[model samples]
Target: MAYQDEITHMDRAELEALQLERLKKAVVYCYEKIPFYKENFDAVGFDPYALETFEDLRRAPFTTKQDMRDAYPYDLFALPKSEVKEIHMSSGTTGVATVSGYTENDLKVWGDCFARGIGYAGGDENDIVHVCYGYGLFTGGLGAHYGGLNAGAMTIPMSAGNTKRQIKVLQSMGSSIICCTPSYAMYIADTAIEMGLDPKKDFHLKAGIHGAEAWSNQFRANLEEKLDYKALDVYGLTEVMGPGVAIECMEQTGLHVAEDHFWIEILDPETHEPVPDGEWGELVITTLTKEATPVIRYRTKDITRIIPGECACGRTHRRIDRLHGRTDDMMIIRGVNVFPRQIENVCTGFEEIADWYQIELTRENSLDVATLKIEINPDFPMDEIRKIEDLQRRLEQALKDELATKIKVKVVEPYTITRSEGKAVRIVDLRSEEEK
Candidate 1:
């Protein structure tokens, strides 16, 4: 691993010691430099000065995403603009953009974090790194680009779109490490086949680091089989320095948290209290080393849990399970909470359906309606109308078994649904303003 052994191989005691040491300084700095933190802490009667251990740190008030969005462009920044070297932000598809700034050192830390992630995914100097995530304000492309360069690999800044050109580069350049959103990777695999190129034989892809959207284990397995490469899951958000928070190693069990830079706690979603080590809960993170726009106990709203056992790859920094879904991603259907990931799990189980899918939501006659839209596998015998109808029936039944609610399933022709260059849209809510 590139520049990784020092922290990656640290034992539990050593890693926790580093986390404790940094946690103290991070809280004090946030309280002193960011007035928002100061006011939040003061309002809860939580004194940063009294912080001594993990227990005390938990006493600190939770920092929600709304807190950061409410802060807006630069209000959450801990330093003056003169010191901020770069700025990046979320796409704000859910709401207003949450701004994040970085100092020179912060950028270096970001590079190091992603370099370690790249190494975990088996990226090396001998491999050509192809980064396909969108660039500029979004952190996916640039962060992976930094990590590729930092790892001393020949990095290609593809920055999404132009599928034919992307395939040309993949074949001609012999790129070995591909970084992009999971949905884009799936699209690329489909496109390669449509272009009559065997994904396993034509391209030189050895591994992929896919993130930026939630995908099920079924999706990853199907993707790996299609591309004949290791599909590693890398997790992050713009607020937490992007694409570098947790990275799945070749072992494929779970993602190792960057414990030296982050302190994570899994708390129950409804109660907001720490759960047992192996229980599912919301992931709350504290930026232990970030300088420019640090957040303490930021509620990620991501649903995951700590894996109980040790990873086979020997990375001692604790692993968290791949996210099932975000709390914000949940929707109520027929008195049951339905998540996009649950739909994905059910849809991907069938070989007749393509990986691409979407859910259409609307309100009709004072009742909510949700429809699952999936594309048929192009190679499947679509001329068999009976088979198509049978597939749809099975899908509806499987969905009801999984979601405990009947979700209308409609199978469309191949390539009917839009392909994504970045994070794929899972839900298309067409509810009227009055209905909402």
Candidate 2:
């Protein structure tokens, strides 16, 4: 597919050529404006401009989550605080928040990236977008808000929660597109059905942009079927910016990163070295053009590949596959590494289960116990409780067989789990005995 804009639509050679010039500028900007970068570069006896090409990125020290935490508020910004018009931040689950300031021009670039993403997912000027992410501190809400307006669409800044209100606005305004977590969309579909509304017939939705949580392909397919919309994957983190870092197009093959805005590299987790394009590795990004916070080789920990081949949709920008798992989120149970997606994949295989499930990790008998509580549809026959029990037994066996570990399964009433508006917390670990 042809790219949406001239600057973003450039061919690989042209894009890379443009990036080199921007990279040089970014390096100089960082050295001049960011105290942390200036001292680091000076101590290393390295001149940021002397090193050229993407490969030279390795020469710079890799940035980590801790760096952002240490920097706290404006330590990493490449411009004066007076020039910044807005500030965005990480959730600060670990106590210290990583805040990034943005100048007026920076906000324009952010809007442009998100607008490009909207178009990639088949948005047009006439579309009405309902942004269902958090508004303040978090990046998703405002990012989508600006992008929708930038695309010349009627924007609805419906910042999450109050499902009834959200549905009312969606119906009253005739929203054409929605941006939220995939699970939230499913929850909305269920609520609409409960309210005697046919989701497929009542809404004007043509497409949905879903992200902020790791999900399986089966989940995506199911969401498309239930919501009657083309669901696309969006990828990003607060450290990098927000949801518009990269996005999947109508091709639905993989997410195309904005090469002109950020440089991406995949590295082996163990060695912290660059891996081949197809190999699974931790994602590292360099802000070739970021002015507020320019990060060099910042490790993202999310696992995926960068597919360099041209997309059928015709965009020349590199595409990164949907995240499989993250290094920090990987759970180690009895020496076997487990991912939430693996559990999700296993749970969705059961036809009777409602696809909403959570895994609880607790300690008992001096061993780690994994309990999978899943919701089942109400239509399940009361007389066939034994049969359903047998099915649960089989499911438990299947999970152990597939995951190479034993796990307990619990069947619960429908709609038992909490719905997430932002990123869902699916795993709860209580291995206190083991830790002690």
Candidate 3:
């Protein structure tokens, strides 16, 4: 299923060897050019110049998001600002923003990384690629744009918002590939329906590249049903090079990491020790070829396990299971741990609910309370009060069984919840300072 291969189909031993070579080169470059990496390496008594094997990476000090924030504007750049051509950064609404820059070569590498993803989605020059991710500061929009250009496709820079116009463009332009967040894609489908357009028939979309947030396979299936196209996941973050680190091919088995460009590892979130494949752990990564701002052993905080064995698609790169959830995203309710993903799984399981759902947490009576809000599907028997009551009870029971913690469920009328134009807000915590 792989497109003509020069790098993707490399033999396992050959691929690992190439990875080791790039890993060493990047480590040495970072240690010499960036004082930040050198200081961290010296503080940990880890010698990057002497690193001979992948195991040595375990000894290197981690680069956290806080570290990037502490460094602020340009402290982490290995190259001077003059040499850096472009930059992208996180919203950093929570704290100081994390900025990543790219040299000329770095930009090319970013495009190359995402172009492989386009190939995985079966995209070619004949396809008209429409990119709807937000532009400026955010990486999703430009990342997909670069990929489409690299793949020799007719690419459109339709960066986010304007759902009505997006649908019209898709209909008139005959767009075959759509790139945006999973939530925005959902909004586009709903808007098209509101305009009395059948997304499946009216749009010529063949694939949907959805990411910028964690999503479940059940949600993916629902998207496929609405769009009538194979839905794929593209993984990336601004801290690293965005939207090209990994992607799900037609196999839809797991997301294949671009091992040649990024070294990925699963580690115990608490202990930071490496975990084997098939066991859930925090994700850690190191940029192998980034020139402007290379990260060594960056702790992503996201949780996933590696998929064992080779992919049927013939890519030597390893694949990781879709993100289960983030450690920071976990909440304790009634002395029990719960993840929004768990609640989402339960919500998506019921056939009588809409694709949009949210989890809200509040503190009351010295206890943390969680409430799940879901919208009723049009197909649900809304006229029957008994059926509605039964559905609500069933959802509550399903949440209890899934999380082993009781959560209140509120089933509201369709279109009651606000739709998202970008990354969906899945969780809302309103607990005040004293409540915390």
Please provide TM-scores, in order, for all candidate models, with all chains considered together: 0.97, 0.95, 0.98
User: lDDT tens string, model 2, 1-436?
Assistant: 2225675567778888888888788777888788888888888776897868777767777788898899987788877788888899988876798887787877877887888878886787878999998899889899889889888888999888888788887777899889988888887887888999887888888889888898888888888887788899888788887888899888899998988889888999999888888788999988876777778778998999988678897778889999989998887677688888888888777888877788899876666678888878778763578977987898899899999988788887777788775666688776674462
Q: Which candidate number has the best lDDT?
A: 1
Q: What RMSD, rounded to one decimal, does every model reach? A: 1.3, 2.0, 1.2
Give model 2's TM-score versus the native structure: 0.95
lDDT of each: 0.90, 0.83, 0.90
1-436 per-residue lDDT for model 1 (tens digits): 4557678989899889889999999999999999998998999999999898998987799888888899999999999999999999987877999989999998988888888888897777887999999999999999999889888899999999998899999989999999999999998998898899998999889899999998888888888998899999999998889988999999999998999999999999999889998899999999999999999999999999999988998889899999989898798887789989889888877989987889999887787788999999888988899999999999999999988997988899998899889989999999988897
Candidate 1 accuracy as lDDT: 0.90
The best candidate by TM-score is 3
Ranking of models by lDDT: 1, 3, 2
As for TM-score, the candidate ahead, 1 or 3, is 3
**Local error of candidate 3 at residue 374 (angstroms):** 0.5
Error of 1 at 111 (Å): 0.8
Q: Which has the better TM-score: candidate 1, or candidate 2?
A: 1
Candidate 1: deviation at residue 67, Å? 1.4
Over 268-335, each residue of candidate 3 has an lDDT whose tens digit, in order, gives 99999988899999999999999999999998989899999988987878999888999889999999
